[model samples]
Target: MNQTLHAIAPEKGRKNKSTQDDVVYAHIFDAILEQRLAPGTKLNEESLGEIFGVSRTIIRRALSRLGHEQVVVLRPNRGAVVASPTIEEARQIVFARRIVEKAVTELVIDNAEDSQIDKLNQLVLEEQECFSRGDRGAGIRLSGEFHLQMAEMADNPPLLSFQRSLVSQCSLIIAQFESGAKSHCSYDEHFELIDAIKKRDKSKAVRLMMHHLDHVEKKLSLDDDNASDDLKAVFSNVRGKK
Candidate 1:
């Protein structure tokens, strides 16, 4: 796991226990979102502890938190691995996202300030730039962030928390099912929803949000039965370089 460790290590001299745990969690979380850590990739605590220069306890805490969010599965003897979502769970996740995001967009329209709208617009522009530069991973991560940003604009903590979980799960689903040619969220659709919010058109915003979600869900090839089961092959490139 040397390569993965080198890639994710905290900067020199920044070693606080709590901070290290958060860093470990965020690193794994972002890796999952970017599809760098694929579904079924084993998260061995000892290797992870070595990688991050932390202890098994810190690794356990981070993995436990991910387990709580359903993004990682903690099997007793098997240890933690990236969650491989079932087809049914994928459908349910999309369904929940549609319901929650429709409400989120409406609340954003009602609660967002001018500056917040500007921030959303800026984020889309950055997302577009990521796509244009052929950085698909960053683009995908930014796309997920767009929905989270909308939830934040709503200023509802409970809703924001729920939306965060849904978004994280959707990342796993996308990793599991989406074809390489497919992108996460369409840039134009995001701009259209922002435009509707700018106009404070509740009906239009909700309609566009739902349709946007439908468009995303339709891009996945959910029927594929081939998921990687070889743990060594899955982590080959990312781990044990040095």
Candidate 2:
């Protein structure tokens, strides 16, 4: 994984508990979105505390936030780990994404400013560049970011927050059950959606959004199961050196 663990030195005068919690949450959250922390990978609180130089309480706070988003699961005595959605759960999540994003598309057309559309175009260009350089992990994460950007442009806080959770859950689903020949979100389709929004073509934009989601869901191999469970191995490169 290209995502690196930034130094969260315990002695850096960082006495703010909330700040530490946010840093840990952002790192693990980005790792999951980038597929660095694969589904079923254990996120041991003690190990994470040692890695980030924080107490288990802080790690638990971060993990609790992730668990609330359904991207991480916390067990009573077993500790926390990245979530692995079941096949049925995967289907429902994808279906829910399509619904929410379709609404997001319509909202964008109605509410988005020209500047917002321009920003989205820039994001697509960056996403395409990532793919061209063989950075599929970053590309996939940017692909999901495109969808979230749409939610942001929609000017609906509730929808944006909900989409955040759904997008992460879908990432876990894709990581666990995607076919070998993965069908990533196409940058071209993203450009087309942008065009439709520019023209205020609500129906076309909504159609494209749903169709894009259809392609994503079709690429998943729901019957298969795959994951990594070793916290040490998974986070070896991710953890800062002592």
- Model 2 per-residue lDDT tens digits across residues 1-242: 22312111121244344377877886787667556676777798888888878899999988997887788999888888788787788889999998899889999999999999998998789888887887766676677778878888999988988887888778667656777534355799999999999999999999998888888777777555333455566557657743
Error of 2 at 222 (Å): 5.0
| Each prediction's TM-score versus the true structure | 0.82, 0.84
Clashing pairs in 1: 1-240
Error of 1 at 126 (Å): 1.3
| Per-residue lDDT of model 1, residues 1-242, tens digit only | 12222222223253343365666776676567556675777898887776667789998988987887688999998899989887777888999999899889889989999999998898788778878887765666677778888988999888888887888788667756777544445678999999999999999999999998887777776654444544344345545432
Model 1, backbone clash pairs (residues 3+ apart or across chains), number: 1
Q: For model 2, what is the alpha-carbon lDDT of residue 19? A: 76
- In Å, residue 149's CA in model 1 sits off its true spot by 1.3
Q: Highest TM-score among the candidates is held by which one?
A: 2
